[model samples]
Target: MRRGVRTEEMQEQERSKSGLLLRGRLAKELGQHDEAAKLFGEAAALEEALAQAYAAQGISEQVWRHEFSAAGCWFQAGNFLRSLELCDKLMATPDAPETLRERARSYAQTLRERRDRLWTELLQSEHTLVAA
Candidate 1:
């Protein structure tokens, strides 16, 4: 295969991941949470596979972004733990951008705080309801 053709093929595969990621984002924006979650999960798997493949070729920011977006989709869907795992993975990689690392840190902190507060409120409300 010509080098150019091979590069095109790789890019095409990369784009398939991106397409699914975009579909998930769009579906979520349209209030189709279930569809969005399914698409996001598929996109996440594809992005993860692509990231590993590209890592073997060389560290590439584009591949990292695919993984980032997949995780971000989960974050947007309130899957904080999964998103935190992805963020931690990205942040630990030497290839990740400083900005991305910082953002991931910020997001992880926010998610932790938010989930805690939400649970606290829920517990308090439940306690009150039980007493009533």
Candidate 2:
């Protein structure tokens, strides 16, 4: 039946999503940040695709979670701008849960502070080099 096929397809997609998340976690634990970031990004894309297929089914919760995970991955990978962009996306979503929005705001602040510190350190190093 059509319903059975759709159910099976959804289950398969869920499995794939889980696998990606698990692998991304493992990569992060192992300090393979770039790989973890790539895997998380893929998982986020898959979540978006699944959302499209389901026509907004559980859209707000799922999108916020996936985006948050991807944003964390980007942060770990030192891609601050991308992480901040994802945080911004989450914050801008009208239907996002309050908890998710709070997390995004926190992450954005952390990213901004981290970026500013890195820039200052870099500028200091450059100045030292020029003076030397």
Candidate 3:
């Protein structure tokens, strides 16, 4: 096998981030949305833990990258609030890269709008029920 090629032994050794992401993408392509989301959520959580560890070690680039990745995975999993929370934190990090900060800002807006829309729809449905 080539240097970077994955082997069976490597696969059996751990549920690594790349493996989880690959599995999640496979599940998504199989139309198993919930399963894919679950896998993505797990990936997101793992990324978050990595980010926290990097942060503790004062590695700004790795921390920002992992945080952004975790936020993206949460978004894929439809966990908007968690994604938005991480995005917001990234946006607020003064030392984080501008590109990532810009992306986070954009994600935050979309997440906020989505959250507000859900709340508004729920309220409207309740009002309709009460009126009826």
Top candidate by TM-score: 3
- How much lDDT does candidate 2 score? 0.75
lDDT of 1 by residue, 1-132 (tens): 111122565677778867987898899899999888888777777767766666666657755776677577666656778877988887887757899888877877887898899999999999999999
lDDT per residue for candidate 2 within 86-114, as digits (tens), equals 89988988777888899899989989998
Q: Of models 1 and 2, which has the larger TM-score? A: 1
Candidate 2 clashing pairs, residues 3+ apart or interchain: none
TM-score against native, each model = 0.71, 0.65, 0.75
Better model by lDDT: candidate 1 vs candidate 2? 2
TM-score ranking of the models: 3, 1, 2
Minimal lDDT window, size 10, model 1: 1-10
RMSD (CA, angstroms), candidate 3: 6.3
Runs with alpha carbons beyond 4 Å of true place in candidate 3? 1-15, 115-132
Model 1 TM-score is 0.71
Worst 10 residues of 3 by lDDT: 1-10
Residues forming the 10-long window of minimal summed lDDT in candidate 2: 1-10
Across 26-130, the per-residue lDDT of candidate 3 in tens digits comes to 999999999999999998988887776666666667778888889989988989889989999998888778988998998889888988998899999999999
Per-model RMSD to reference? 4.1, 4.6, 6.3
Q: In lDDT terms, which candidate is top?
A: 3
Candidate 2, residue 23: lDDT:
96
